[model samples]
Target: MILFDQIIFGPIHSRRLGLSLGVNLLPIDAKICSFNCIYCECGFNTTMHDSPIPTRDQVRETLDAKLHEMVAEGQIPDVITFAGNGEPTLHAEFEGIIDDTIALRNKYCPTAKVSVLSNSTRIHKPHIFAALNKVDNNILKFDSAIDRTMKLMDQPVGKHINVAWFIEHLKKFDGRLIIQTMFLRGEVQGEKLDNTTDEEVEAWIQALEQIRPQQVMMYSLDREAPTQNLQKVSVDELNIIAEKVRAKGFDVSVAG
Candidate 1:
């Protein structure tokens, strides 16, 4: 499993966000998440640590030190991203951390954009919603328009989370949200699942029309997914889906 031990780790090149610096708010040794997704690169949410999550002050201090060093070395990142071992919004001090990150970004790397990669499960929280709105890129995951496919792919912690309710809640973001969808096919425990199918794509496009996001980022699996049965959708297939999404009169991009 790939895990980030430092609070501030990568300054790696990303297909979506260039030269991004990553901030990991979750515990260094374990994965603490609200969803147990099958495709998570960090592996399953198996280790639940009781130890206190990184405090607001700790995050501020660590991030400040990193950013200062980068600035001194004349190596400013293109973006400062919140993506680590698990759900960033799950942290008790998430809002405060966002505030700190923005401050650090402004002081050290004014050109860098602040971004958060969230599962959208916690959008119901007022504070989380507010923090997400403050970021330059509020990327939220939307794997499928069908509840059954979502359950099979994401395996959200909350069993009650269905697509209908999810769409209604996601609409709250409106223009600020960037919807990210993963296109893939696989069978888990004898259940066949594929979100790239015509029926699935049509339903998803309908949902996107209602959500009206700033943009849609569709991509296939790039690394080894935790679920071994999954297959990556080709770039050609992703572009085909992107074209369909664009036909609905929304901005769309494919990264495969």
Candidate 2:
């Protein structure tokens, strides 16, 4: 329901990241994420689009202007987040864009952290990996560690992207990244699905232990999902799970 019409928008308060400024690398009129998650706020992906993805120079200039305006207004963002209608890593100039963003961030809002909310699909690429490592908070999505649950929930565009694929690549971060998981329950095509189940949670914990991320971010549905029968996992349930993971010495943050 929400497609960011501008290249650089927001400075809105985020549940996970504070006073955040958003950056949309995909087309302004269409969604181009690698994963067609049922809970994506902008709905499913659109193949056709009227506008093009912003270029590196355009992003840098517009972001510079925005940061200048925010500075003049005395309203600095807590984080400059790369998130919007779709995946930011898919952009051809993503590495260059991150470079420009870091420069602009240092020039305008030195204290503002640069964060990217990726689906953990493109991190296998050397350039993408380098770019993510450069960011202050490289938040990646790993909704379910079970292959079946992940395929059903995330519906990754690449058929090869299974739980194992994620684990193998996520481990490459080597405790430098943060893992973000969405906890929820529902039925898809008459099949019952719930990541909170003991089996699912245990497998997820195992994957986290292997990755050894610096922190883990857990949250449930905050917006209407495109599909039906989806149920939101409550804050109490999230905390219950967080406690188990925390026992394993993983710093977990819950945004309910």
**Tens digit of lDDT per residue, candidate 2, span 1-256?**
7899999999899999999999998889999988999888899889899998898889998999999999999999999999988999999999999999999999998999999999999999999999999999999999998988998899999977999999999999988999999998999978999999999999999999999999999999998888889999999999999999999999999988
Q: Top model by TM-score, which number?
A: 2
User: What Cα-based lDDT does every candidate model obtain?
Assistant: 0.90, 0.94
Per-residue lDDT of 157 in model 1 = 92
| Residue-by-residue lDDT tens digits, candidate 1, 49-127 | 6545788998899889989898999998999999998999999889989998998888989999999999999999999
**How much does candidate 1 score in TM-score?**
0.97
TM-score for all models, in order of appearance: 0.97, 0.99
Clashing residue pairs in candidate 2 (N, C-alpha, C atoms within 3 angstroms): none
Q: Say which candidate scores most in lDDT.
A: 2
lDDT of 1: 0.90
